[model samples]
Target: MHAFKRAVAPVLTFALALAIEPALAGSSETGSGGADRLVGGNGPDQIEALGGNDVVRSLAGEDRVNAGTGNDTVDGGADADSIDGGDGDDRLQGGPGNDRIVEERFGDDRIWGGEGDDLIKANRGNDQIWGGPGNDTIYGGPGKNVVDCGDGDDVLYYQRAGTARRSTGCERKVREDSTIQGRVCGQGGTDDADALRGTSSGDVCRAGGGNDDIEGAGGSDRMFGEDGNDRVFGRFGNDVMYGGTGDDELQGGRGADRIFGGEGADHLVGGYGRDRLVGGPGDDRLEPGWGEHGEIVDCGPGKDLAVIGPGDRTRGCEGVRRGG
Candidate 1:
C-alpha cells in the first residue's frame, strides 16, 4: 500500500504544479499582454501590440498606433488620427475629421477614410479602398487595385503608357504624328475601368443625381452623365460612354470607342483611333476629330462645328496624316 501511494505521489505533485502555474503566470506578470484595453484620453498617445493577433484601440486624443506585425485589428478611435501596420495581415481605418491610414506591402489590404480630407494607401499588394464623403485623390501602382469614392467629389489616377513618335526635325517633332494604341489583337486582356468619371471643380457631380461633368482619364473606361449639363472626357483607351440627363459633351479620345448623347442638346466628338459616335436625343452635334495628327481643338458641343465621316480609320476630317 505504501509503495502504491508513493508511485501515485509524483503524479499528484505534477498536477498541482500545473494548476498553480496558471494562478502565478497570469497575474503580476509585466507586459503579460493582459492589457486588452488602454484608454489614452485627450493626450497624444501610442499603443504597440507585441507579436500576436491583437485588438489595439486608441481614444479621442491625437494618437498614433502601431499594431506590431502579426494579424491585427486596430481602430483610431475618434478625433484626428494616424495608423501604421507592420509585418502581418492588418485591418486599419480612421474615424471622424481628417485621418490617415497607411499599410505596407505585407498583406492583402483594405482601407477606409471616414469623412473629412483623408489619406489611405496600400503601398503594396492587391488592395481595396473606399474614400467616404469628401474630395479625394486615390492612386494605385503595380497590383490589382480598386478604389471607390462613396460621396462628394474625387479624383483617381491609374497607370498609363504614353506613345509618341518623334523626329529631330529642324522644324521640330511635328506635334502631328502622335497617335494612341490601346491593345494588341488576339491577346488576352483585363477589364480595367477608370473611375476618373464624373464632374469635379465643386460643380455638382452627383453620381446619378446632380449635373456632373465626368472624365475617364486613363485605362479602358466608361461614364454616364446622370443629371445637369455635364461634360464627359475620356482621355484614352477603348472606351464606352453615355450622357443621361441635361445637355452633355462626350469626347472619346483614341481607341475603337462608342459614345451616346442621351437627352438634352448634346454634342459628341470622336478623337483619334477607330471610333463609333452616336448622337442621342435633342438637336445633337456629331463631330469627327479635327486638327493635325497630334494636336487638339477645344471644341465642346457648342460653338465648335464638326463633321462626322465613315467610322474609325476614315480620313474624312481635314487633319495632317502620319508621314504626310
Candidate 2:
C-alpha cells in the first residue's frame, strides 16, 4: 500500500503540473482580459491574447497568434508564422521567416514583416506597414495606409486610389479594382521609387527619381521613368516609354510600341508587333522585339551594341549581332 501510494503521488503531481501549465505541454494558450505578457517556446504555438493591451512573443517555430482587442504588441520570432492583431492600435512584428500577418480591425496599427518573403495585410484604419528585407507582398485594405517595402523586390496591392502610400524599393503596385475597368494615370515624385501602371484608355504615367518600375497595362499609354535605375514595360496596346537617366531597361510590348532609353547604360528590347527602340547616350544594348517586322533601332551616341533582326532599320549602332 505504501509503494502504491508513492507511485500514485508522482502521477498526481505530474498531472497537476500539466493542469497548472498547459502551455508547457504544447497546449494552446488563452490570456485573461487583463494585460498579459505571454511567451511561447521553440515549438509551434497557438496563442490567443484576449482583451487588454497584451504582449505576446512566439519565439521560434511556426506559430499562430491572435492579439485580441486593446493595444497589443506581438512578435513572432523566426520561422513562418501567422499573426492577426484584432482591434485596437497594435504593433505586430513577424521576425525573420516568411510570415503572414493581418491587422484586420480598428485602430492605427503598425506592422513589420521582418526578413523572408512575407505577406502582410493592413485592413481598416490608417496603418503603417514595413516589409523588411526579402521579397514581400503587402495589401492596403481601406483607409490611408503607408507601406514601406524595404529591400528586395516587393509587390503592393491596394483597392482604390490614394489608399496606399508606398515607400522606395517597392517593385510592383497592383490596383485591385473590383470593376474590370482600367485606371487613369499614376504619377510619382523625386524622393522615392515608384511603380506606375497605365489603363485601358490612353493614359500618361510619369515617375521621378529612385529606381522606378513602370508598365503600360493597356491602351495607348505614355510612360516616363525620370531618374534612377528604371524598368519600364509596355505590356499592352500601343505604348511609348522613356527611360530618363541611370541604368535603365525599357521594353515595348504589344501593338505598335515606341521605347527610348535616355541617358546612362540602357537596355532596350522591342516587343511583338512593329516597335521602335532608341538608346540615348551611354553604352547601350538594343535588341529586336519578338516577331518584329520593319522595326527601327537607333543607338544614339556612346559605344552601342545591337541585335539586328530581319527587316530592322538600325543606325548609330556598332558591333551588330544579327539574329538567326
Candidate 3:
C-alpha cells in the first residue's frame, strides 16, 4: 500500500531566478509519436508531437516539456528539463548538463546521463528511479521523492522527509553577519543547513540527509545518520548521533561524542567530542566525540527518556528517575 502524495512545489514565492529557456515557452511542438527533433521555444507539446527517435532540444535558458502521453525521447540542451509525463514514460536528459528534472504523474520516466545531473522526482503515484552523480538514478516511487546526490560520484539517493530537501535560488537568502532567512529558517542565527557552514565548531549538529558521507572537518562536531547508510566525522567538536534505520559509521574526529543505533546494525563512535554513546536493537559498537562537554556521562534508558550526567542540574533521565 503506497500513499506518498505528490509534492506541490511551494509557489517559488519569492522567485529570485525564473530560469528562462530559449524558444520553448511558446512553440511548434508535437503530441506523441516516433521521431521529431524539438529545437527552441516553450512547449507543453500541447498537441502535435514527433514520432520515432524524436529529439526535443532545449538550448540555453530554462525549458519545460509536458512530454505528454508517449514513449518519447527528450534532449534538454544547456538547460534544466521540467517534464510532465502525461501517458507514456519518457526519456529526458540535461545536455551540457547541470540539469534539473521534475517528474510528475503519468510516467515511469528514465532520466539520466547529464553533465551536472540534479533530479527532483516523484512517481505516477508509485514510480521508481534514481539520481546520478556518476550515472545516478532516482526511484522516487511509492511516494514523494526527496533525494539529493550531493557533490560526489554516486548513484541512487535514499528518500526522506520534505524537511530534508535543500533549497536554491531565491529559496536561499543569506543576510550580512551571516543571517539566513527564507522557506527554511535557520537555527536562530544561520546554524542550519541553508548556509554552507554551521555555527560553532564544538557545537552538536544533525546535518540533514540525502545520500551522503559526511566528515566534521575542523571542529568537534556531532552527527546523526538518519535514513541511510553513511560515514560521518567529528572533525573537532563534541557531538551525538542516531543512525536511524541504516548501516552507519559514526566516527568522532578530535572531541568525544555520543551515538545511538536506532534500527539498523551499525558502528558507533566518539570521533573527537568526549561523549557517551549507545545502541538500540542491533549488533553495534561505541565511540566518542572530540574534546569534552564537561564530564558527560550516560546510564542507559531510564524509566523516563531523560539523560542527565555528573553534577548537572538537568534532572530528566538520571536525576529524577523514580517519577512520583
Candidate 1 local lDDT, 166-220, one digit each (tens): 1011111111111222222122122221122322221221235444445554466
Query: On a 0 to 100 scale, what is the lDDT of residue 251 in model 3?
Result: 48
Best by TM-score: 2
User: Which candidate leads the pack in lDDT?
Assistant: 2
lDDT per residue (tens digit) for residues 1-324 in model 2:
223223322432232232222244333678998888777777778899999988787777777798999998888877768798999998888888777788867889878888876778787788777788886778777667767777887978787576544444589887754332222355444446665667677878777777776767658988888888887777558888899999997877656888899999998877555888899999998876544467889999999998766888889997688752
User: Regarding lDDT, does 1 or 3 come out ahead?
Assistant: 1
TM-score on alpha carbons, each prediction: 0.38, 0.48, 0.32
Clashes of 3: 76
Candidate models: Cα lDDT each? 0.49, 0.75, 0.42
**Candidate 3 regions with alpha-carbon error over 4 angstroms:** 1-36, 41-55, 125-130, 134-139, 143-324
User: Which 10 residues in a row give candidate 3 its minimum summed lDDT?
Assistant: 1-10
Model 1, C-alpha of 77: deviation from truth (Å): 1.9
Arrange candidates, best lDDT first: 2, 1, 3
Per-residue error (Å), model 2, residue 49: 0.4
